[model samples]
Target: MTAVVEKIHRGRKFDQVLQGARTVFLRDGYERASVDDIAREAGVSKATLYAYFPDKRLLFLEIALTECTRQTEQAAAEVEDDRPAREVLLEAAQKIAEFKLSDFGLQMYRIAVSEAEKFPQIGRAFYETGPQAGCGLLCNYLRQAVDRGELVIEDLDLAANQFVELCKAGLFNERLLGVDRKTTAKAIEKTAKAAVEMFMARYGAKVDA
Candidate 1:
């Protein structure tokens, strides 16, 4: 078994190689994907692909899960910090739900799980980017909301994780288990709204009588 490389060796053909691997991984998944196939798709020589990735696992991580962190990172970028907690939290929840419920997101997760037992790093990296980073983002926004007196929460960490879970509750579970495979604009909005309402009900600062 090969050790997972945390850092990618980025060269001139880096994006080209990753683009190829992305296509193959999304299509063939981790276990069945072939380096030769990826190299062919990339239009690079086998030697060149090996020069950049060294092994299939490294390439898989780069294309499948590592860069997903880069993609999922904009969850809070457009959301203003001063916005009402309900609005900000709703936006954040929607972002989480959209990504987690997306086809790409689902693929990213499946690849991580399929490879996790053999490569623990895959699981850690997935959780770090998926749940941990998401929770951190929510914590930042929730802290701002608290500072603004929009919500009253004693445990910021718990609240952040709870909100993330709320976003994933129904449809995410269904889709992950293959019980329900479709996600729509309507479902995303509904999940986000419900998560925000529950969060606000639990934490929204009350007015004095």
Candidate 2:
């Protein structure tokens, strides 16, 4: 039997391994983390850990990719509605803001930022899985708006990127800081509302939504 097959049949708890790996990676950062540390954290033998992930990089990469895919899918699904394009996009941004506050989201963004300069591959994969996918989902909705003459965008792709960038510029920074301040939920709502309004003003024809 193949190594991969054996690993699968070994009754390995890959999900638990990933959870422990995520904790180790987040606590130690990518460069400082090690296979032994991850193995110990996961309560698995080194052999078992290696049977699944070849190295720390691959393990962290898988974690980031999984999170990115999950968040993107959830974000896309949350914004799915017959509401106006502006409203839908704003709702998506709000959902993204909420996600940014989650432990997994913060860790993923931190990993990407810390390694992006030295390890472009990690950054690229994170972008492809997260922002790029989110933009694609948003572009699909924007294209529909264009069809109805709701936006004067000559390029739906660029518009989608711009919209995401606009929303992220605020939420991403706040999240990177962990937003630990004891701000009220009302303040968060205000911030999200303003971000959406500003974003809509730039590209929206009818901003009432």
Candidate 3:
């Protein structure tokens, strides 16, 4: 993880730059956002912005990584392991759907894919921090469910990854491809329910059919 840690000219305006970048990135997306826009959003000079982050990619990466961890924390914090596997899983599904269709998540995904060829680290790091970390969190909960006889999964890792993908099945593609700018809450809820039901169909041992 430390291997890809970007070196920056860290200073007083470091947090300010990060906050500014987040605002612009969410508003303008990866490609449209410029250094000047970020600087203006942050209320810092370009010299100060460049002083903290030498490259726009690095700035975006930092924000994406932080958001990734925040997403993970959000899921972990809200989901109580003591609950029935169905409840926990539904909550997880809802959270995953929320993130994938979010402005930050969509833009980050596009930026990582677009930059991967030129800066391989960007893609690798984003996936590692985002999807991979997400899978790992799901795996922990899934393993517990299996142990409790709530789920009968043979492959925790694969099942975890599959569940994450299932969460994205509805509006994710349309949103990613620029087909839909605003996804409805009803769609997201429907998708989350379907994902959990499908997952339970394969893995449930004690769960209701």
What's the lDDT for all of these models?
A: 0.78, 0.70, 0.86
Better of 2 and 3 by TM-score: 3
- TM-score of candidate 2 on Cα atoms, chains taken together: 0.72
Kindly list the per-residue Cα lDDT of model 2 for residues 1-209, writing each as its tens digit: 11111223224577778888988977886767888888899999988887777666567767878777887777666765467766776677666666665555676677677878887767887888887887888888888777776666778888777766655565566656756533345555666677778766776675464
Q: List the candidate 2 regions with Cα displacement exceeding 4 Å.
A: 1-13, 23-43, 54-57, 169-171, 174-184, 206-209
Candidate 2 structure lDDT: 0.70
- Model 1 scores what on Cα lDDT? 0.78
True-structure RMSD, every candidate: 3.2, 5.2, 2.2
Q: Clash number for model 1?
A: 0
Is candidate 1 or 2 superior in TM-score?
A: 1
Candidate 1 lDDT, tens digit per residue, 1-209?
A: 12246455667998898888888877886677898899999999998998888788667666655555665566656768766767777877887888889776887777678888898877887777667876887788788888888889999999988888899888988888889878888988988899889888899999999
lDDT by residue (1-209, candidate 3, tens digit) is 23235666667888889899999998888889999999999999999998878889888888988889888877777767789998888888888898889988887888888988998887888989899988988898888878888899998999998998999895888998889998888898999999999999888896356
Among the numbered candidates, top TM-score falls to 3
lDDT of 2 at 22: 86
TM-score of 3: 0.91
Ranking by lDDT: 3, 1, 2
**Off by more than 4 A, model 1:** 1-9, 24-37, 54-57
Rank by TM-score, highest first: 3, 1, 2
